[model samples]
Target: MIELVLPARRKDLGGFEVGRVLPAVLKRAVGPFVFFDHMGPADLPAGIPRTVDVRPHPHIGLATVTYLLDGEIVHRDSVGSEQPIRPGEVNWMTAGRGITHSERFEKARAQGDHVDGLQAWVALPEADEEAEPGFVHVDAAQLPAFGEPGVHGRLIAGSALGLTTPVPVASPLFYLHLELADGARFALPAEHADRAVFVARGEVEVDGQRVAAGHMAVLATGRATDLVAHGAVTVMALGGEPLGPRFLEWNFVSSRRERIEQAKADWRAGRMKLPDLDHDEFIPLPGDPPPPPNPMS
Candidate 1:
């Protein structure tokens, strides 16, 4: 029922902190999730600019989904999409062929807010790797919800425990967010070929394995795994059919390493278009130019 536990590597993204869990040296990806980052349980000081955080950057051959637990973010993309995502909502952006975007904390900059959430990159199938890039934003009310007694959850994408979200995904996958009251129990659905559980808050015991916050546990298949919450907890459970092997570097993911190299040159030569709304400042390729100033966050 349990395979291995991967702890998040804490990193300070200038102003706040980010916990990078996936693309691990131990496991590069779980199912279609090639990259995963726990973005700050850290506070953002008032007026924290977007440049201090993540500037406009490009991605290809993947979809980026950001689900926040607190605060809000303004997402601007090359597809002419400008949306603000609040806690409980999801912003799914597909960089099929190529796309660039920027995340700015507008409300937080004007009025301080907390930034806490999980962001994951889903690898596009080799067939759809060159499809047209797109973006979608689903409100919390649009996602499917389920619960009984102390267990309450929302299905972010794909199917889970008899419920499914309308969120459009390029592949078979299930991303769930569960909030369990202390003493409550949960059973991870075994509907997918690969499954993983991430403890975002509190603690839990899964089949005698104690999984604490800031850690992601890879679960074995074959049957549902039972877990009990020691306290009120937030659990993110996700998995799906694997997309075979993928090459990931910086912010690009592809099936062939040459594709990655080509993406590098494309970005270096300014072949990729910036977000229509955020075109002034972009994060240059590593070593291309000096970095931005670290503002208070």
Candidate 2:
């Protein structure tokens, strides 16, 4: 059953920062998901410019999903795929063996554009870690929408309301983008009893407990759960089958220790290609070394 796991808002850092996260995986080894980041629903004043300049970075053993609630992003990958992802659209990138990419604004927000969205990383099984890299872009109209008046649900990934996301993935998982008007209440499936809710906009009450914006509400594992929107609200729910043993090193994710080690070496030796970008300010630099091996291993 779905159980509330994480209940925390994205902590802000400085410039261009909305929320930064290294989220906890509540069940099993990272669960069926790994990384989740709640970005902006931040507003930009007219005539002020802003841009998302995530430099080229490498990822392995996972697929990345970029969904926008407002604004647009131009995604470019090492494989030469470039696409503009607008509101209600998704950019799903699968980095089987390994892939590098960058996400930046299509145009300066000051130029009358705005930015708001979430970036998620879903892990792949051990066997698919080294598969070829690929990507799929799904428009807003293609995703399934359901729920009663005053409350709406968008199935960004996995299946809901008899509809499934068009992006190919490795496991059984669900990513829901939902919004509810004030005074609206909705029920989640009993299977999602342990799910976590990240409140991006406004406040909500789960099982009678109130949670405001910038905070997360983790539901205790049990039967079906209920939530009421105290105001206009937006939340993202991630649920899936539990994952097995895995390790994260830098941006590389793998189930095998040796594979992660090799990925580190490959990156250090410059064997992997970086995503192309017009500016160098956003490029990702090499980070601190990985942690020591597990003593029990």
Candidate 3:
């Protein structure tokens, strides 16, 4: 069995740490999944109050998938969506052409509240890259859930196990949230051209190789393998066939480099629209002026 282990790099945001796994030096992407971030398994530590806030930002030619293991977030988009997403639920926002949005920890959260989640960016097919933007939220109950003796799981998106999720996706793909009891094992489907398993917590072995928490194991293409949990464990299985080459710049994604540059210009010129409520605030463009000449040459 061929396996490529991707170590996560921690990025600090306010009071939390997000482990970035995809777009690594060795691997740029897994199928259409171009960006993957595992946020916070951190505690708030009493007497300190911090609210997760991601100001309004723009995106193009991709869909954002937000899945939470704990805590809640309110999502607002230019399409007039103001939805509160909770654990086990899904918030899928497609920036087909262009869209701006913001995510903030639910205002009702009390001090010392805990938060943790996973966020990913899936590039859209070239044909639908300029389709109208949209947003949808699916509750945990609306998704298919199944269990056998020692394994339980929910279809977070795409298709798996002869079942499909309600989350709208433009291309072929799969994302599953699974929990396994000690000694339990589950087999991978060969249908998806690409596949990987992320050990969210606890310990697991994929095709006989040990994978620790916070690490991802990319499986060999079209190979059938088994993942066995050494103890109670949580895993995220995600992948699909290739979406072809995509140009990713800042928060924009497109098949053409010019589209990304156009998006950047639009954002910097204050021409990009934003959510009705969060229209007043946004992250500014990062300046890239030429570096000053070296002084000690």
**Which candidate leads the pack in lDDT?**
1
Report the alpha-carbon TM-score of model 3 versus the true structure: 0.93
List the candidates' TM-scores in order. Answer: 0.96, 0.84, 0.93
In lDDT terms, how accurate is model 1? 0.89
Error of 1 at 98 (Å): 0.2
In candidate 3, what are the lDDT values of residues 103-130, reduced to their tens digit? 8764434455577789999999999999
Question: Candidate 1 versus the native: TM-score?
Answer: 0.96
lDDT, candidates in the order shown: 0.89, 0.71, 0.86
Q: Candidate 2 vs. truth: CA RMSD? A: 6.6
Candidate 3: Cα lDDT at 134: 97
lDDT of 1 by residue, 12-57 (tens): 8777788999989989889999999999897777877665557789
Extract clashing residue pairs from model 3.
none
The TM-score, computed over Cα atoms with residue i paired to residue i, of candidate 2 is 0.84
The best candidate in terms of TM-score: 1
Residue ranges of candidate 1 with Cα displaced over 4 Å: 291-297
